[model samples]
Target: MRVALGVSYNGQSYDGWQSQPSGRTVQDQLEKALGKFADQRISTLCAGRTDAGVHGLMQVVHFDTSAERAPYAWVRGTNSFLPRDIAVQWAHVVPDEFHCRASALSRRYAYSLLESPVRPSVDAGRVGWVFQPLDLAAMQAAATRLLGEHDFTSFRASACQALSPVKNLLRIEISRRGAYWRFEFEANAFLHHMIRNIMGCLIVIGQGKQAPEWIDEVLAARSRDAAAPTFSPDGLYFLGPRYDARWGLPDRTPAYDWLP
Candidate 1:
């Protein structure tokens, strides 16, 4: 049987989502806990792969297992062996055709940034910090140029294995609450380090370092060197993917509302 799970984690402790030789990844921990519970190996495929130090509010994954257990049981039993930073939020039985990644319509991510002079102490690894006050209008204008389908090679990582540099960026919402800025992104897909690179450009524009039209030049260049450096992964959060209503999967976890 195939089962789907909504998982959340603080990525500060893990290398990334994918399994590695060190076995310190979120996938490694979840699979190990799952193996302990089912008495057999259970491999999972996730909706999106996040980088190290990036958080996941509701990362969806599907795994096939011979273990016969109720959805709630799968959630409770699996989490029993998992670490405090990671847990299964919900579980559901899925059809054979359901895939965690390929079946998704779009994915969402958010970056929480702190605009202040002093460095962050309590929220050091939870938010990105900049000393200068950002111009929200400037950032918004620069972000507007990123909407729609385009070759995002300028912002893609050199190590990105994605077949194509083109992706349909559906939305980019920038809002500020107090001293914190929240940048929300929705897209059909994203290349490795795409959002982080774009964030660097936005921060530059917001700080009056460049004009809003600078993004257009970067896109036209289609070169990684043409864009700003990749921003820190500390502030990034995977908000999960959007599946069809027929899947009956939860769109979000409690952590969604808790994010700044």
Candidate 2:
């Protein structure tokens, strides 16, 4: 049987979503816990691979397992062996044709930023920090240039293995509340470090270091060197993927409410 799981984790402790020889990645820990629960080795494929220090509010993953157990059993059992920072939020039996990654229509991500003169203390690993005040209008204007389909090579990372540099960015919402800033992004797919690179540019524009139209110049350049440096991943969160309703997968986990 094929099973789908909605997992949530505080990524501060793990290297990333993928497995590594160091055995300190989210995937490695998850698989190990699953193996202990199922009494056999199991593998998983996630909807998206988050980078180091990137949290996940609802990370979907699917794996084929012969172990016949109730959905709740899988959740509780696997989580019993996992660390406190990671937990399997929900589980459901899925059709063999359902692929966690391939079935996603679009992926969503959010970055929480703290705007303050002093560095973050309470939420140090949970948010990015910017000492200088930011202009909301300026950042929004700069973000507008990134909407729609375009070659995002300027924002793509050098080690990105994506087949193409073109991606359709569906939305970019920037909102501020008190000293907190939230930037949300939805896209058909993302290249490695794409959002972080864009965040660097937007923050620059927000601080008056560059004009809003500079985003256009960076896009036209199609060179990574033309864009600003990649921002910190501390605030990045994988909001999960959008799948067809026919799949009957849960759109979100309860952890969504906990995010700022």
Candidate 3:
């Protein structure tokens, strides 16, 4: 039987979401806990792979296992062996055809920024910091140009392994509350470093370093060189994927309430 899991983690202690030789990734830790609980080795495939220093509020993964246990048992059992920062939030038995990545209709990400003169101490790794006040009007204008399908090569990392540079960016929502700002993105898919790279450009434009029209020019260039440097990963969070209602999977976890 195939099992789906909703996971959340503070990525500061791990390398990233993917497993590596270092065995310091979120996947590595999750597999280890799952294996221990099942008393057998287990492997998983995730909906998306987040970079180092990026958190995950609701990362979905699926794995096949013969071990018989209740759905809630999978969550409570696996989490017992996991670290404090990482957890299995939910578990469900899924159809054989349900794949965490391939079945995903879209993926969501959120970046939190703290616009303050005082540098972050408590929320250092949880937010991107900017001393200069940002222009909301300019940032909104720039972000509007990024919506819809386009060739996002300018915002992709050089090491990106995606088959195509084109992607459908479904939404880019920007909101602010006091000194905090949140940038929420939903896309059919994303290339490596795409959101971070776009964040860099938006920050530049918001700070008046470039005009909003500059985003259009950058998109037309389709060259990474034409865009600003990739922004910090500290503020990035993988909000998980959206699937059809037929899957009966929870679209959110309690962590969603804690975030902007």
| Candidate 1 per-residue lDDT over residues 96-135, each given as its tens digit | 9999999999999999999989988898899999999899
Q: Can you write out model 2's per-residue Cα lDDT over 1-260, one digit (the tens) per residue? A: 99999999999999999999999999999999999999999999999999999999999999999999999999999999999999999999999999999999999999999999999999999999999999999999999889999999999999999999999999999998899999999999999999999999999999999999999999999999999999999999999999999999999887666676
> What's the count of clashing pairs in each model shown?
0, 0, 0
In model 3, where is the ten-residue run with the lowest total lDDT? 251-260
Residue 175 of model 1 has an lDDT of 92
- How would you encode candidate 3's per-residue C-alpha lDDT over 55-129 as one tens digit per residue? 999999999999988999999999999999999999999999999999999999999999999998899899998
Clashing pairs in 3: none
C-alpha lDDT values of all predictions: 0.96, 0.96, 0.96
Over all chains combined, what TM-score does candidate 3 have? 0.99
Query: What local lDDT does model 1 show for residue 68?
Result: 99
Candidate 3's C-alpha runs over 4 A off are none
lDDT for residue 78 in candidate 2, whole number 0-100: 95
C-alpha lDDT (0 to 100) for residue 167 of candidate 1: 100
Per-residue lDDT, model 3, residue 114, is: 93
